[model samples]
Target: MRNNRPMSFPRQQARTRRFTIGVPRAFQISPDGRRVAFLRGRDGEDAAACLWIRDVDSGAEHVVADPRTVGAGEEDLPAEERARRERLRETGAGIVSYTVDDAFARAVFTLSGRLYAVDLDGGAAPWEVPAAVAPVVDPAISPRGTAAAYVSGGALHVVGLDGGGDRVLAEPEGPGTSWGLAEFIAAEEMSRFRGLWWAPDGSAVLAARVDDAPVARWTIADPASPEAAAQTVAYPAAGTPNAEVRLAVLDLDGDGVAEPRWIDWDREALPYLARAGWTGPAAGGPAGGAGSGARQDVVFTAQSRDQRTLRLFRADPRTCEVREVLAETDGTWVEIMPGVPAFTASGDLVWIGRGGDREGARRVLLVGGREAGPPEGAYLRGVADVDGERVLYSASPAGCPGDVELWLFDAHRGTSTPVRVPPPSPGGDAADGTGEDAGGVLSGRMRGGTLIVQRRDMDTDGVRTVVLRAADGGEPDGGTAAAAGGIESLAQVPDLPRPRVRFWSAGERGIPAALVLPSWYDADSGVRLPVLMDPYGGPHAQRVMRSRSAYLTSQWFADQGFAVLIADGRGTPGISVEWEQAVRGDLAEPVLEDQVAALHDAGKRFGFLDPDRVAVRGWSFGGYLAALAVLRRPEVFHAAVAGAPVTDWHLYDTHYTERYLGTPQQHADDYTRSSALESWGTVNRPLMLIHGLADDNVVFAHTQRLSSALLAAGRSHTVLPLSGITHMASEETTAENLLLLQVEFLHRSLGGAAGVQEAPKGAGGV
Candidate 1:
């Protein structure tokens, strides 16, 4: 239970970093199920995350490595590492991620650009890897556990676990060329974070070589620190030339030297390297072979620049031969999902496919493929793990868009069903054990017979994790009784008021929404409260979900005297393919229409919402939507706070923006129609634009251009420029005060009680 004490919501939100500072994540369950390793902060307020492992037998936890003890400071990150973390929106400190070997005996990670390895079985202190280069990034231990591969100085290097024979496997061929690293678009938009993948046998590696020479360069300078030189970045804006990405098969020998064999593919046609990985022996090729063995299959997925066609290919690393396995095409765009183009243990290809005649849902298809599950409303999100006979995945079933449940499909039995792992009750007992329903959004990973299940819902303050063993009857059997219990969460208790959330569907499209009323509000008092519509309302994200923590900020705003409504209409994920594609060709119209529809419908159902006093607030895509609401539909939205909004589609990236809006040259009108810059003249509300000057994703120029247009149109608006923030308002003081400022602005703009004092001196611009 949380401490029932008064605290500043904004301060707590900042201190705890939105309740994510100490949460355990990036879980890796050992194949033998004896141990589970994760990264978490030492305490809720602790920013530096440490690597910890839990013993499945005795339920004991061991701190494998602590940055504080290792003499590594989070502030010592390399420039490349800092940029990578920024792309990932990772704000935490210390060991944020690590990779283990196949046997789970060795784990390798880079802390402050120094490579370190820990002996999982020996309980020894982590030691630095002997590298020719001092700074390292993305250290991955080979599957056999004898060697590790990492990137340094834009080159890939490998070292033996015995601390000898460290050598550069691949070096840059040209000025802007780098090996074993994801390109900007691949990392920023495609969600394929890694640039290299190891072979199952550890004998070879499939690596990507990136050339950024053709991409346009943009300089970001710190205006406050005039003495520092500006940093230049390769930014591939819409319609601009992208980084040249290619894959190579690097064969390694015992001497730590690698010979690269370039894989042949039509780089001009399929330019985007969406995904690349190695599937185990089940993906058969040659039997009883050594180098390009029959057991290991090198697979990759590539998409055209327009993103309308995606092709999956399997390659022979020994010969650098490639064969297309599957190809998908759509007129609008083909979606690239995570954990797909995988092979089941028996050599069957597994992937997530768009809707077919059998069902109007995104489903798992086994290649030569047939739908693995029942053709219904179950929208497959991603594959978690694939064992010999079973595939584990996450999906949202019928009428449960807010809840994602773990499901398993037995390839042998041809049965797909939800995995019913018991959830922990408030008292920490099994929900079933206490005769209560375990209702929540569930996600899990399976290894051998062990399963690690994580559950989060509106009823809980934090995520609950449980480990279970599979029984012969195909049900969860409590493994070592003590170890089988819910894993103790070291996350800090957010001592904040519980959200009074009401989940419902609104509008004709059945847009999912959650309406949060003030805890002290009396429904029968006949007081119509002002409304605040908060929504991301875009593709790849959902604002309304089953997690309680997802509503914390919205609830805080509600407690500040407004009814907060979050909606996920068309273009938001977790519905059908059609729902997600609704915004294609024109990113603005349908999304804004859905938000408008959801607002009106929710106001009609929830009598306490005052439509005339409604305000909208958001960041990123939501920020764009907020600005759109006031500029184009001021009659519906009275005021807005748009933070880091995308003012023009041409300024965005190729992979993300081109997928929806097409090329600016080809579809000039579409970009013109979708951009907020074109509609600035219609603004008739108290609009405030907030942007971080250091943001590279949605650059500060977005806000600057919009503010300039508004000023030219003689429209009244405010622009708040954050001097040193990025896409994420991660700075503690800035994040806390930003929320307070938003509340103060809303209260003043919406005719409520004047709240906080004026904004800090230099925070505002015009």
Candidate 2:
């Protein structure tokens, strides 16, 4: 029953949010293993997400809560909620995220600033917690399931499930202070989304208090609407002071009253709050058993401003005493992997440690006075879940740099082995040449003996999720359950044409890359094609992966009569640690050199790329690389479309920029060399600068300054300013038309139907 219809790729891509609208995400498996809760939009074109639950036994699905039922429209988001979503890069609406109690009996979420709680076992409709304030954000039910806590109007509040005894737990003391919320840097750069964690006993909560008074303010205005007042934002640029963040434990009694006890830590030495959470009593301890009154352990991860040192601290919530458990140091910056510094039920501290006989490989280390890691060559990615004595994690297997697989490490058994998660069925409608079976990416959660695994590969169109009994054959007890069942995804099928991708490594550095050819391309014709080098060649972000959907845009560009090349040179993740850290202290040289090397090697092997007519296009970090290509190496790249590019490293944020280039005062030469602004005077190729005027992240000043410098140098360039777009082009029309405009520009500049034009002789003419 496939509905094949005619549709514009650009319009469909924009309307579907890059085909992510209907995907089921944020999966949570109940400890009892009875139900799995997730969020999904109504369909591919629907932007409003609804909460859904699947029965593990019968595989029956039910819609627990829908925004439409509550009469809340998608456009009524609070200012704080909007800002949070922006930082998360989330484009969906309606129950975008929700939190469940430890027992998974109840769930809490916010829609249009109204907090709603649902009883999972009772199957009752969600009821609003009558808040004195209208808008609330980040609501979470207490572990005890009797109360819910949320942030509203710069204050943290707790209310009972019966909608009674509503009281404020903490409030801001100054104009720029807020309780129970993550600051801009923490949310945007550090990847620590939540600002509060509830103790396992539900007797208390640990919350973050952020004070932004010391940060500098920047005004963002809409020039098209001159009469409107400009929006002011507290921005911490590189080398600027970040918001002061302090953690406090809030003791919540049965009556919904709370007393705050501030945790003592050296903010001057470790200013970056990487993570915080509570762990139960150590294994075999007096209070380790259920119903024990022994205080739960509070753990946190902190990093120095330079990011070279990261420390794990254990704090006493009662007396606020902090003690260091472990510390890791690196010559370059240390990466903060997600789901680490976690404690096993047996009291062992689980973490990712670097260099254990593998030279530069990151390995999962279990330490409880003693340290142990997985077999050599297993590059640990992140910790997924820690049940009793087993830790489920994702890692790149030995000799498979492009594949990520799930492995279970049992500290009690002292064995680490791959989990037998099912892979996608072979012989489907995979992207042209990529249908060959490669390892699928594994991600999921484990509770008790039940595991919820989501599998995706380059050959699959969408993700497949399954609930299964553990490998040890332990079945969860509770709820009309029989055996494990697969969760059916209601996501709409993308009707676009399938992409034809070829994955390979190029150059001596083994730079990973993917090449896409047009659907109508005929290799027998022996016609050389124009080359479009599309890359996000920077740290943390990878352009080349085993996922097929990751190349949809590149495939579309290829269909427009050009060969598309996406290279993941040094500085990208999912590779060895050495490759990721190769760009330290010098961002431009190695990255640009790797891109050029990939292009030449790819062209030499394929013999279909016309190097003389090459153009590059990218956004953000990729945009910076695109501009750098033409400005510094004009002879290699003839044209480029740079979108929201960071021309100067100084204009970027503190954590991300400083991690690579260090402080501007100390590494001034590195900043100058890494900045695209420094080489703008040498621009000798056709370049178009695209930027959103309202973007506060990279700011329009980057484009403005670059254009000014280009003009002063008597160089010709095109600048396109988007009036109201941010770092992301969320506007449907803008996102859709941008693709078409880029296609048209590339066609004209690279000798397509629009006719080719050569630059002036001194401008590095092709």
Candidate 3:
């Protein structure tokens, strides 16, 4: 019986969107580093975020705009906006994103598809631009703060802030074409969400025109509401054709009728436009400070359809001529690093590459075509931000996969130093890459000379955001500290018991693993607990992080009378590139091997773990792994719960699926060897499949096909279909019941007693 519990941890977690609503995020710092702009909700439970600015020295914050006060009272999101938010995993309601002008005079954002601009100086209320089309998207304020450019009805338009001079700069010429909008592949896989970028001087805009005529369309229909029309989406599945993307320059000073000068490139060889922007002397400088229109150069990166070759090019916007700046090719497909193709103040190219060759050369920071820093063995994640001559990056120190730390590279000083987090006690060094604070995660942004460091550690509950100045620490010139001043968070404190987690490296490979036992579990009780292996054993993500928040859900599961084990295995990131690439051409074996290896090693290490009653549960790639665990290695995992899993990789998208398996047309064996559908007939365990009927990312068909295959084999299983829900089960009722139902199923399948615990005292209900 799935009876609801008042003030339950699951309900509160869902209501507060995992306690992320009131956290200060989407930050932008002014040139002087004295003021910072951010987005946050008014209170812990407030869903709509309000725009705020913090006075660095005074430590005072004031709301610049509240969506409830300024908006149309309801959000009528466009399909494009909804899809963009889905891809971004943005759960907040109001002012999700905003762009500031070069001078930091005003900021532009879109609400309910209408455009709104507010002065950052706090003297005026935000006013909606009446000239814009009803449904505008991704409005960017010009560098000179004169006008804003936005996309509407598949066309690019510019509206003057002063004169209200609205004009259509570029329009779609065909049915499947759109201007200033990212293609599905770019947004879902490449992380390049926006298709238009402003030139440094704001006189011109570089926009992408996408034509999806060649792509195949898939239907997403509401089975429950058959009267609803089926929505068709362009899905470039593995081996299918992708949308054609091209770049063009649109001058804001023109009459809005002339044809845009298209950037020249060999599209046949490199069909994927990875990134695009303008680089100039005015980059990150004052409004229209130095670089002008004609002299500015547009830069972009492109990749081959197979994704093995990546090229960066510099283009002359005037002549539409392009020159290749650099090229990197790999036999196993190149990984796309974030915040790249950037530049230093001295006109040096700041890029992340394999240093030299794909073999042996580690992923390192490259400055002006040279291997810059991070020593040799550290795993360089990406260039966080480049301020003048200083480059901030995130990385996992050598031999420490669970710890993610930040390091700064000073081009002027030829030195690379770790950005330290202050010790918990006084008179100690900042959080360590491997020292006492070895289990922390750090992500921050740097602008001008100011740095914003957001940290989540095992010692803390949620995130702690600190603002540091040039003199306090993180000043590009010199000085570094744990933190200077902190931005307060209104996020709700978790109502669950503190997780009793122990971290360690498992096996000879030293896979990062964590064990979360119930707070009530006693070693001397003589009651051996069943083991639950939880893992996201895939690429580009890690499970065994040092953050306390990362394992809250896992801890909740552990409290249900089981020892939850989490692992970051071979295919997961934050480890070595070789470890991540181990699954190439065979995504099933290496990952599963690591998971099983970690489980057995953990079972042997922990005396009270009952290995015979082991179970596995996961979602997305983790879901795939959980089901794979039972189907392929039933002796190790007796029961499984897979939610929204990719049962057959052949149904997955191009950019992500093709990276490891290539085209299914070329490597059919890899798909068969990797997908859970290949081993469906071998199932001999209690298996449950859960999926959302309306999920676009991992569509419902994935579960349907696997269920059909299992039925064909006469294997018994359970399928729970969530109607009218997407990939994210954020609804309070659904999310809470999902937990309750999963725990009930595990107890019944494993023949264990129900172990639901009440909320801790003083923790109010949702």
Candidate 3: the clashing residue pairs are 7-765, 421-430, 421-431
Off by over 4 Å in 1: 1-6, 254-257, 281-294, 358-361, 425-438, 471-483, 680-683, 753-766
lDDT of each: 0.79, 0.77, 0.81
Question: How much is the lDDT of residue 200 in candidate 3?
Answer: 83
lDDT value, candidate 2, whole model: 0.77
lDDT of 3 by residue, 1-766 (tens): 0112346678778888988878889888787677899999887788899999988777788999999989998988998898888888787899999988877788888899989899998999999886557688888888888888888889899898777678899999979999998899999899888888888877788899999999999998878999999889899999999999999999877586447999979999999999888775333322112233345788889999888899999899899889999898887778878888787777678888886455675788888777777766788888887777778888887777777888888888888877765544242212212223445888877767777878888887788786655443456432344344677778887777788899889998898999998766777878888988889889988988888898888877887788999988887888777777788899888899889989889988988899889999999999999989988898888899999999999889999999999999999999999989885435488999999988889999999998998888888889999988788877778988888888778888888832334323322211
Clash count list over all predictions? 3, 0, 3
lDDT of 2 by residue, 1-766 (tens): 1223436777767877887777789887777666888898777766788889888756688788888886465558888998898899998888898888777888888888888888876458889878778688887778768887789888998888875667888888879999888898988998888887777777777888999999999999989889989989999999888999888999876454466788868889889998887766221111111212455767888899999999988888888888998898888888988777776665667777765554644655564544455557767788887776667778877656667777777666676666654433342211111112457677878775677767667766766666766433463221211225456555545554567788888989888888888766776667788889999999878777676677788877777777899998888887778888889888898999999999999889888678898999999989999999999999899999999999988888889988999999999999998988785435488889999988988999998888998888888889999998889898899998899888888877776821123211111111
Give the higher-lDDT candidate: 1 or 2: 1
Least accurate 10 contiguous residues by lDDT in model 1 = 282-291
Top TM-score prediction, candidate number: 3
Question: Global CA lDDT of candidate 3, please?
Answer: 0.81
Please report, as a residue range, the 10-residue window in candidate 2 with the lowest summed lDDT: 283-292
| Winning candidate number (lDDT) | 3
Q: Write the per-residue lDDT of candidate 1 for residues 1-766, one digit (tens) a residue.
A: 2332345767667877787777778887776777889888877778888888988667788798888887454459898898889888888888888888877888988878888889886459988877778688888888877788889889999888776768888999878999988888998999888888888777787899999999999987778889988878899999999999999888886454466888878989999999887766311111111122256768888999999899988887787789998798888788887767666656777787765663353556453276786337677788777655667778887788888887777777787767665646657734433122345688776765667777788877878787766534243322222225566666655544678899888888899988987766777878788989999988899878888888888877877777898999888988888888888788888999888998999878988788889999999999999999999898889999999999888899999999888899898988998999875435479999999888999998899899988888888999999988889998889998998899889888988821212212111210
TM-scores for every candidate against the unseen true structure? 0.93, 0.92, 0.94
